[model samples]
Target: MVVREDSVETKHEAIELVLARLLRLGSLVAAALLAVGLTAMVVGLTGIAPRLITAGLLVLLGTPVLRVAAAALIFVRERDWYFAFFCAVVLAALATGILLGRAGG
Candidate 1:
């Protein structure tokens, strides 16, 4: 079986497009949640506003991590060891930072 260069490039482009869309969707959702939360707060619905804001912030923070995980999965599926390894390292670092931040706090 032979894989052509153009096909590989196409696959790469498709993967990038998927990732880009994921990021854009995440950002939009987070922004919407934040906006609603703030509006709720201004309208005096304080009880649920904070929770909504926190959720939005969490989603914003997790977006990049999710993107990395998705990329890692895609790379692993495509048998791209180098990119997969780098993604793993980045994930580890992100995890470590979160852990350290929590511990310090």
Candidate 2:
């Protein structure tokens, strides 16, 4: 069995590539949804258009959050436990804030 070792820089670069792809994909999906929503609205199909718009907005909002989560997973893969733990903590805090905000609303 052969195990290859990667330097920390290489690990970070790998994660960056993954994050870039994720962002690009998220942007594309959000744009498509927004376009559809706009078209629907223009054509007087009011029912689903607003829902699609909201969904697109949500995807745009969630991209960075998902990126952070992916970073945590990549850290775990690279055996960087400290970074992984901190990222997890950050995610937890974000989730708590969202929950609290919703409850208050």
Best by lDDT: 2
Pairs with backbone N, CA or C atoms under 3 Å apart (clashes), candidate 2 = none
List, residue by residue over 43-89, the lDDT tens digit for candidate 2: 99999999999999999999999999999998998887999999999
* Candidate 1 lDDT tens digits, 1-105: 256646766666667887999899999999999999999999999999999999999999899999999999988877779999999999999999999999999
Q: Which stretches of candidate 1 lie over 4 Å from their true place?
A: 1-3, 11-13
Q: Tell me the whole-model lDDT of each prediction, alpha carbons only.
A: 0.91, 0.91
Q: Which residue pairs show backbone clashes in model 1?
A: none
State the TM-score for model 1: 0.86
How large is the C-alpha RMSD of every model relative to the true structure? Answer: 2.4, 3.7
TM value for model 2: 0.84
